[model samples]
Target: MSALTLAAPAPPASAPPPRQLRWLLRLHRPALYAWTGLVVVLGALLLWLGGPLTDASEAAWKQYNACGMAACTYDQDAILLYKDVARYTGSAVLALPFLVAAWAGASLIGRELETGTAQLAWTQGVTPTRWLVAKLALPAALVTAGTSLLALLHHLAWSAGRGRVDNTEPWYSIETLYAGGPVLVALALAGLAAGALLGLLLRRSLAALIGSALVTGVLWIGTFLTLPHLWPAVTRVSSLRDGPSGSGITVAEGLLTADGDRLAIPRYCGSSIDPACGSLFDRLDAVSFYRDYHPRSHSGPLLLVATGILLAVAVLLTVVAFRVLRHRTADRKGAAV
Candidate 1:
């Protein structure tokens, strides 16, 4: 019997190491450049005309701080800048960069699948995990940087305006735009997860974009409008001016207005007026008057809870997506041989 010589089977091809996939993330720079440019321009404009911004906030906050007949006063133009221009505009600015980040995140994997490029990458020794990580790394960094920059800008603008207040207006201080910490992180993560989910389900760049937009819109509306007030309390102060001590507070015989008008509420809770009302109007005399009004807001707690839920969902979905995409890629490669 002749000695049998058996040929060994060829080893399977391995994917490129994770590092090359990292190198691929450099493609996100172009979009970052454009967004940074816009932020710079907007910042310059706001700084130059912060006077008007401060004036506008003054007017609004003063109105919010007004007691029955005793209303606070401030420059209307400055109040406008702080309330209308700075706050809203800063939010809008922060939103733009995140929007771009969402589009990029959604496009990363989805575009490859849609265009058949992912298949090519797989064949070229790039594993699904490496490809996904590579694609996401740079964009995530850019988004974080962008958000930080926007937050800083908002802080400076708000702080400057805060200095002009006389400490009597309820809504005129800098603590109003307080949604920074984990809330922003949650929002960014939610956007990324939304993009990833779209990419996986749709497998088309345009479809992923649409999906991201829809998800983000729903999140914004749902968290801000519907969820916060779901549990309504007896007293709702929904404005910056509803703070503890920032309006005309008096301790006298009656609720005295600046014009010497007296006012009273039907029911007095204690020796002091309800903190929800003001401190100045707890007198024995009976009269009806709206205390200096500082409308309050409750957007913070609602946002914090929503942010936590979204972040958890994002993490779970991302893990599922990774497993599915990796499995699908491996299966396809096996069949192609």
Candidate 2:
């Protein structure tokens, strides 16, 4: 009783720290909904493509093939539907990176910075460093998870149609291959990083949005130009009669000399089975036609190498984003502390 009387009232318990993540979720709720909706729609379409659509298209192809050079009756509607769905979905999947970059730059970082929301947060419980971390870490995880899911589903859907639907894209087809692999996931991550960095640098929403998308576009173009060269192309030599034999992505098809010199095909010269072509080949000392190509077996290596390059660029951009944030915050006179 005496101790209780003598003791000073304990200091009021400090208010519980604000949940930064709760605010983050609240702030980005619309984006979250939009992303969820997009994933759901795409996922549903992919499942349909892999199952019913594929089956229907395959059946139609069988009927058409069986009729052979005669007036044929088949489910032409199913085939056209399959093609349209596949084309649209594949295009959507491939376009995701640039779309993500645009949104990330315009809404995620640029708007926050441009509107003073980020600076306001820095004065509260959240430091500039912590704010940046919160902004990037969650979005990065979500983007990676979502993009990876789409890619896996796409690959499976594409695989289901292979050998079944004659019109299905080959494995090396750029849109099909990129949309249906881990490379898409890596590219998405890089786009996120690019958007964040560009938003921070420009500090203007529209400018950052355009800049990010352009950067991502450039990244993709570079990957396209660099992919085939990343892995060594196998040399498939066929006698000049067969006209350059390998089956997957063709890098180069040219005449090979007896001394092993690779020569470009002269104008109008193709298969040596052509009398004119054979005559020209014999005169040029061409002993065979050699095709430098990446077969189906090389798909794994090409995907892995391209993915690695994109990931490296993403990491570099992320580090720079953090550094830039720190420097900017440091100049704000302890506002971030």
Candidate 3:
């Protein structure tokens, strides 16, 4: 009699662990969709600005320039229209950092920690460090990519209108400088870091949101104030009668006297040619009208310096966030024991 020993079915194999990135994507699907939609819409707007809007604006500008103020009637409306479009587009690009900060604070880390999901995640085979890395890295990569693309598009659009559109902003204008270069990417990343750090420190979604916004605003303002000083300014000395020349970012312009004193031009000296101004200039022995400016060539160096500073700050914030998290984790383990 053969002993019928039924072979036990092989134990079911455990499913492979879900990837960190996949889990992050699944958790923040709404953010992903929102970001995708924003990029698409902005991209379309930039294309239009570079293409049809640019053409229309240029045509209108030509017509206006050709017609004397006395003869201007046909395309006056187009000038205003172009200005409106440019302003709106610039505003949208400039607002990206604020949006990134808000999302990072309210949704990315704050909400997760606030609701205890971050702790839950750690229990599911994810370490706190890995969780924070996933949170920061994914958003940072997306922000850098999106902002970089938009900046390139913006630069193209702005370049297309440079010589043709009379009303277009100069290259060194603050909005143009920030929104149409890699600086925007740096700002976005900085905002993300600031938000994350605040979220971790505050541990409450609303508080994190407000604190992050304030910190981001301060960073932006500080950058704006410090930018002109990032690179050496070019000094031009021209005849007091002729005022300074060369189109660049003027840092300070005043009278350079023969005695080497830098003094503001007198109010009475409205024009260099004014008799009263000429008298004052002669009396003061003003040698020349001096202008300190950041030449167009300095643009690259300034941008690089500012971007490096912002990145350094972001890295600092990230390191502090990790330290805070590790401390909190250790405290919890100590209590449990």
* Model 1 accuracy (lDDT, Cα): 0.56
| Candidate 3, pairs of clashing residues | none
Best by lDDT: 2
For model 2, where is the 10-residue window of minimal lDDT?
A: 9-18
Model 2 local distance difference test score: 0.89
- TM-score: the better of candidates 2 and 3: 2
Question: Across residues 1-337, which tens digit of lDDT does each residue of candidate 1 receive?
Answer: 2334565544344557555565455445566676578667766755643455565565566665674466555455554444556555556654752575357545566786888877676666676776777666676666667655655555566556655643322331222333233445566666776787678778888878877777766765565554434333232222212322223212222243446565443344323335544443433332233333222343455446666776786677678778777777678779988
Please, what is the TM-score per model?
Answer: 0.60, 0.92, 0.91
Cα TM-score of candidate 2: 0.92
lDDT of 2 by residue, 1-337 (tens): 9998999864322321358556865798788889889988999999999999999999999999999899968999999999999999999999999988998888899999999998777655677776777788878888898999999999999999999998998899976789999999999999999999999999999999999999999999999988989999999888878787888888888888999999998887778778998889989999988889999999999999999999999999999999988887777777746
TM-score computed on alpha carbons, candidate 1? 0.60
Candidate 2 root-mean-square deviation in Å? 4.3
lDDT, candidate 2, at 92: 95
